[model samples]
Target: VSLQELMEPEAGTNRTAVAEFTLLGLVETEEMQSVVFVLFLFAYLVTVGGNLSILAAILVEPKLHTPMCFFLGNVSVLDVGCITVTVPAMLSHLLSHRPTISYGACLTQLFFFHLLAGMDCFLLTAMAYDRFLAICRPLTYSIHMSQTVQRMLVAVSWTCAFTNALTHTIALTTLNFCGPKEVNHFYQLSCSSTQLNELLLFALGFLMVGAPVVLIIASYIHVAAAVLQIRSAEGRKKAFSTCGSHLTVVFLFCGTGIFNYMRLGSEEASEKDKGVGVFNTVINPMLNPLIYSLRNTDVQGALWRILVGRWSLT
Candidate 1:
């Protein structure tokens, strides 16, 4: 039941808490739900497999052992984590009558969702810096992004993401869910006592999610400035092309994930909004490896040799 109903008809009543929550599925219609379910299933499969492939390529190919590929591997792991936390559970709830999720489970999802989401933000920013250093200041790129330093960057990103998730989870747990235990949208933490909850939610979206987007843009601006100094058109074209895929990913992730988070309280979460959420959480991960990184000359070359070389052995 909703937290409101379980309360003592008095404000600030946290004694009677909601034990479980009913999460919203993407669509209610049988046909639409089925279609979305299959789509999500396919997306999840592709997300996991595609990301794994990228990770594998990075690991197996000695040529991809640079700081760029190293950071990309971390991104792949974060992408997989981001999608896995939502899609599997969502798929199971597609048409089920028992759509109940325990309060603990809900918090678990919230924690990991924000955790990976935040990691995605920082990792992208870190990647942007990696790109900047490589393109803008190539001489110092190796010095700044040594294996030890890159590992530290990944660790710091992990710490920040964990802290963000922890804050959101703790903040959510303090609030009482009154009545109507059914989650109309995926799941949202609501507070009846104070306005602090809203501020906390907004901070997570803005500080953790929005902040990184800004940093990325700023980093790209610097990169662009440095690229313009190069006299050769061919040289400039190559630099921009290298950055194109990353820019595309930054927009896609921040645009949809932040939109869904902001949309939670403003309107009734419709199928379309849920679809956007799914795309952000599920399909985006799949698209990154497929559309962004997989088609790169380096990755493509590695895959070709692996596949074609295997045929020669056969």
Candidate 2:
């Protein structure tokens, strides 16, 4: 049956509340669905395994017990959460004939997705701050980034993320969803005017998204100035190397995120934009652990030692 037929009210019934939403899976063709499902399933496994490996390394490797690694571990957890919220459901829906999600479940998914994603943005900013202290203010780094201070930063990031997610969820619930239970793109289903939602999005885009990018940029500015003042070429390279992985991650995550969120005011996202969404949600999570492990000798050495130790034992 067509989506319109599914949405139409039964005879003698008036417009009713939306109890569930139909999902337009990534592809319509069965053959394409199978291929896409395999690809995404592989990507999901890699993302989970790679992040778990990073977390495991952080736990077993004493060298990774620093403030930076602590933040990285939290980020790994968030990355896993970020992908798990949507991907698994999407995978299941890909195979089902009538793929649908209940109204409550849909909102719950929305809430957690935003929460984890917002936490990622804040955590990256915190990481940039940590790098700033370590590189620009070396002597005071230990004092400023104490274990207690590190915990506080994490707490603040999560609290801010929770608040933002809650606000968005509440605002969405206030909207009246009268018909058309199909969710094709972003959460743009509302019978009422979305002016309030748009305003909140624009305002919080600055607070939650734009603000972090600004802070990250400012932190790197100081870091760049400090690294330039280094006398030896090796010293400068080392400084840049420490941040290179993080910079790459930040660009990959935030760049696509900004592109997606900034264009929400438009009537609908283009297919190209949806492709960017796939890259952001699926491809980016899988890349983070690889980027860090490949770039950082500490992570590589730790992973290598763990592997060799297990090998010798076996």
Candidate 3:
């Protein structure tokens, strides 16, 4: 049978299987295209430069050789991977008049995009817990969270993220995208589907993403409570300062994430909604390292020391 016949076997039907999709670039105006291209290009370059500098600073500064910097390094790696997954494709589409993505390519992009995003989520939570232990239980922190334990935590975070992405991607792969292959967003992997895939995706979102967020919140709450119990003003200030940057990142990351996913079920989602989703995914990954490094004096000093030839990798 022909492709159309296989898609709609009944006579006089008006459907054919959609084998590919056209991603509606962010906007329709040619002027807007150039503007967005330049803007995002600058952003992408800055993100890459900032994260690479942070990674280099961490590696060169022996003072940064700790579990915290190790975790930060992983976050930087995830940021680069996450931004790379979407920015290149997005930039290409924005610059070109006609933009298209193959079905397989869309799925591949979706897989890595979600993979890095999931890793960021879990890693942020791990970072929070790490800070909590460091601040709230300084004496036993090393004993409880040794180097081996920290490595295990990081490994588990990446493994869980990959598994979550794989589950969503596999579930989406089983979906049949037979028509209307035009995605009305810049960088999403949405597909035509029956109800089963939607339900599975929802379940996976809750289990993999939602559960970790809850745990993260609980951890920070305890951290905050511990900080409050500090009798000395200097101790309270120091503890709060240590966690402030992390808290800012956590809120920005999780707040945008929850907002985006909550709207997935809404039938009335607007183009702006998709725009915000793309903005969060493409922009926030790069911002995480900058926010942390800029806000934390220790990280700033480490970078300075590395730059001034005062630090060595050995």
The lDDT for every candidate, in the order shown, is: 0.78, 0.86, 0.74
Lowest-sum lDDT 10-residue window in model 1: 1-10
**Which is the better candidate, 1 or 2, if ranked by lDDT?**
2
Q: Write model 2 residue lDDT over 164-188, tens digit each, in one string.
A: 9999999999987774455446655
How many pairs collide in each candidate, listed in order?
A: 12, 0, 0
Query: Cα deviation of 293 in candidate 1 (Å)?
Result: 3.1
Cα deviation at 300, candidate 2, in Å, is: 0.5
- Residue 62 CA displacement from its true place in model 3, Å: 1.7
Each candidate structure's TM-score, on Cα atoms with residue i matched to residue i, is: 0.88, 0.94, 0.88
lDDT of 1: 0.78
Question: Arrange candidates by TM-score, highest first: which order?
Answer: 2, 1, 3
**Candidate 1 or 3, higher lDDT?**
1
> In lDDT terms, how accurate is model 3?
0.74
Off by over 4 Å in 1: 1-16, 95-97, 179-183, 186-191, 309-314
The window of 10 residues in a row where model 2 has the poorest summed lDDT is: 1-10
Model 2 global lDDT (CA atoms, 0 to 1): 0.86
